[model samples]
Target: MNIKQPDWEAIERAYRAGALSIRTIAERNGISDTAIRKKAKAAGWERDLSEQVRKEVRNKLVRGEVREDQCANPERDAEIIEEAAEEGATVVRSHRRDIRKATNLANLLMDDLLNTIQRREEIEDEIERETAGDESGFRRSSMLAAVALPSNAKTLFQLSSAMKNLQVLERTAFGLDEKEKSADADELSSLIDELSKDA
Candidate 1:
């Protein structure tokens, strides 16, 4: 029986290109899977090229690539801008998306004021829920239980930090959109009002 010497360069290229599995490469080369894998590694057959090479390839591909719409040259850049503007007006139509947009007010600034109104209402409803829970006398016991019975100060600090963060978020959101005259702002205002009751 005769076993011919494997074409090392071809095997390395196949491995580098991911055209052949390690097991398949081993079978073709008449070597164990481990040996084939080790040879591929030793020969500098990279599975993931260096970050610089990857970045270069990305830049090259992006520069070379063209979108289908971009090739449709009759569509002017102004038309694209106008379409984006039209879409932006109604982007926050849904209550959820409105609140989401309002939370990150920078994105929602171009959105219609109605979105901010709707988002404020959602905030108000959540505030009411919390207020009701607090009124039921269950909140104090629960708060105390969680804080007093916690295993360590870390847990208490985490809860305190979370509550403080929520306060900051509400304040920031309020600062961004001062149009509390809108329905959305009503809820947000109520939440801010309620949270700041002690203040």
Candidate 2:
């Protein structure tokens, strides 16, 4: 069996240059990417300047000072700008979607808290009936009993703080909190007035 030594000097030069990806460099040197990564980490190699290079190129494109090499094709500039814009919009939409999901979860928690407080006795009775004595010990019923209700002042305070934090997140996600009259509210008020007139 014959073993060949890897060119460490060439590898170091390529790694420090930060032009080729680690995988590519490792493949060229006939080594694993993990081996190159370990060597790079041990040597404290500088990060790739690809992001910086792209930023500089983007700035130049925005200023209409693109180099001939950059715009090898006439439509490259437009494509790059369009791609960047789509990437930015995707990030924003993803952020908004996550915020919306968090807000929905918070709203559900609030509702659960309110329901448990208002109908504690009824809910407890339901649970008890569902879990009635069985010799076989087959009591399979849990209607949110696992969810601990805030009993003491400390727990209540914590819940309040969490709700307040959710409120702040909601405000930041969507603009400031507004108390606009909803159509449902107006319709309900109209129905009440009509019933009063009939009576």
Candidate 3:
């Protein structure tokens, strides 16, 4: 009588590796998953460190936070690079939103400043018209003297300073300093390339 014995040792190794499902491993080895499970249970088989590391890397990749060392293969490296690019794009879009908001605020401030100046000019014109026939120029001088600072002058100054500061900050955030002409996109792309090379 001849018996075709199964290589239980190899089966156990594959089971502990945890890369393949029990069902798939069983099919490859020409056995039932139940049989493999029974043997694994009897032998006290548990997933090895590689399996644990793979799981951890998988979780981190999904969150776009996997380090290059954790996923050190071409396929996994591509996945991580793509994830990083997506994260970078999201950041860029957010920066764009900030830029738009800052620009809108500046536009509003400019509009208000123009309106305030126009109102001031109108007030001055009205005073001049009222005193047009004053041969002594006394009333015009007195009225002009009573005119103190414009009501929105302080606000206009503050807004102007704030807008200028905001523009500087925006430029800095994007690596757009006058000395550095390179764009943020280039930095982000190079970052992705470096990650891939490290992997």
Candidate 4:
């Protein structure tokens, strides 16, 4: 009986490519699986498979000759899966950050609108009190003139318009309608809750 020497170079190439099982490579090269395993371990070739290798493995699996378990280093395959999952998670986190930023800006706009309205009301009240007092006609005219300024009215109108637009945007972003304002608010609250929970 005659035995052939193991082709170490060919075995290393097949193992590094990660497309074939040690058993398959051994059979193809007319060597024992144990010999290939020992040579691969000695050469420190235990890493994740390349894309080409994975593709080859898929083809082999499709042909129904090789089972998934027959592939080299199941742990390396699992690590690859874990890395892909983490990449997906990072994308989700980025989207969440963008949503929170927009929400925060909307909240700030709402605060500004509330403060402006309050100030406008306070000014109107002061004007009414001055009109009721025994002030001179000249002073009363000046007070009314301030109230009737075009710029002041325009500013209030613009602020109100901005508030309305922001409200519309919030509703649109949250998949709600004008009539569902409360639902939009609730959705935002729930989103915040979700974000906090993730934190």
Candidate 5:
């Protein structure tokens, strides 16, 4: 029997995206539930239906459709209630971890942005000093304009425009455009020759 290997990453992503059931994931992937469960355990994936159930209960309660006591069966659903509570705690911890990771990433990006701004300012000052005696003022003004920071809205707009332009350039460069055109042999040869000259 040829056993197909499951894509563990895909399975894990699906699980994280709220699939949350070993049997459900296994059935979807045509794998054994035990295999899925093992992989999830190894990946430290948490399953929490309590949060979802709580939200649903809250909504229903607000609409006067269900009472608080009806949320769980005290006798028959004791084990399920305990499991949900434990999983709910796990979910809260997981969310806190995710928030920390996001905060760290934001800090790192902010540092990089500040460094870039500082470097740009240093370069501008150097250029200004160099062009101080030029008398033309054209070079200084042009360089300053080139490095000028835009207002928040303008910055967002410029970034969006730049991203679109980059996407277009990439498509054309990689011959992934609708025309599916690539560089001719002569162009390719010329590029190779130019690169070889640098060597």
Candidate 6:
């Protein structure tokens, strides 16, 4: 029967140095957990408990939150940087002033965009009101132009009312026409036809 023996020296050095997981070391050395643990014990190696505890504490620090010791506590920040150096990880700090400026600029741009949308809606509403008033006037004028029929004219009131409406609509059209660079002539022609229907 053959008994397997693990390389104790390598396992001891890795354990004392606070290296990656036992699984990672196992993969690197092409060995199993039982072999690594047995070898570590044989070499009198103890895990760097402080390094492990520090790792757990740092994991709770949410990414991008300004670290308390980044500038305020040099000792704490130095310790953090040293720990990171030992782990071969980079430490980066962001400029608070630059972040604040970016936040303000983003807020300003959002406000400007919202104001622009509101103004556009207001302009659209005004144009719609003008167009509706113009159309109503046109219809009134067409009905009025149809003229009188009999002494007991039933439709006389309706015709006169339509003509009066057209006169008012023609006035409203001028205001709406000036708002845009170009007016749709076809739409004006359609309004005229609608006005003349009763005539």
Best candidate (score: TM-score): 3
4 versus 6: better lDDT goes to:
4
Instruction: Please give the TM-score that candidate 5 achieves against the real structure.
Output: 0.32
Model 1's lDDT to the true fold?
A: 0.42
Residue-wise C-alpha lDDT for candidate 4, range 69-165, written one tens digit per residue? 6446565554443343333334345554666676677567657656655586687678778677655677766775655546456756775676577
Per-residue CA lDDT of candidate 6, range 65-95, in tens? 3243333344544444345334422211122
lDDT of 3 by residue, 88-186 (tens): 445444655777798797888789667756677677788899999989898887775544365466667878888888887677545467352323323
For candidate 3, which ten residues in a row score worst on lDDT? 180-189
**Which candidate achieves the best lDDT against the true structure?**
3
Q: Candidate 5, which segments miss by more than 4 Å at Cα? A: 1-68, 124-199
Provide the RMSD of all predictions against the true structure, rounded to 1 decimal.
Answer: 20.3, 19.2, 17.5, 19.0, 18.8, 29.5
How do these models rank on TM-score, best leading? Answer: 3, 2, 5, 6, 4, 1
TM-score of each predicted structure versus truth: 0.23, 0.36, 0.38, 0.28, 0.32, 0.28
Local distance difference test, per candidate? 0.42, 0.53, 0.58, 0.53, 0.51, 0.43
Clashes of 4: 0
lDDT computed for candidate 4: 0.53
Which pairs of residues collide in model 3? none
lDDT of model 5 at residue 40?
73
State the lDDT at 75 in candidate 4: 54
Candidate 3 vs 6: which has more TM-score: 3
Sorting all predicted structures by lDDT, with the top scorer first, yields: 3, 4, 2, 5, 6, 1
**True-structure RMSD for candidate 3:** 17.5
Runs with alpha carbons beyond 4 Å of true place in candidate 2: 1-82, 132-199
TM-score preference between candidates 2 and 4, better one: 2
Lowest lDDT block of 10, candidate 5: 57-66
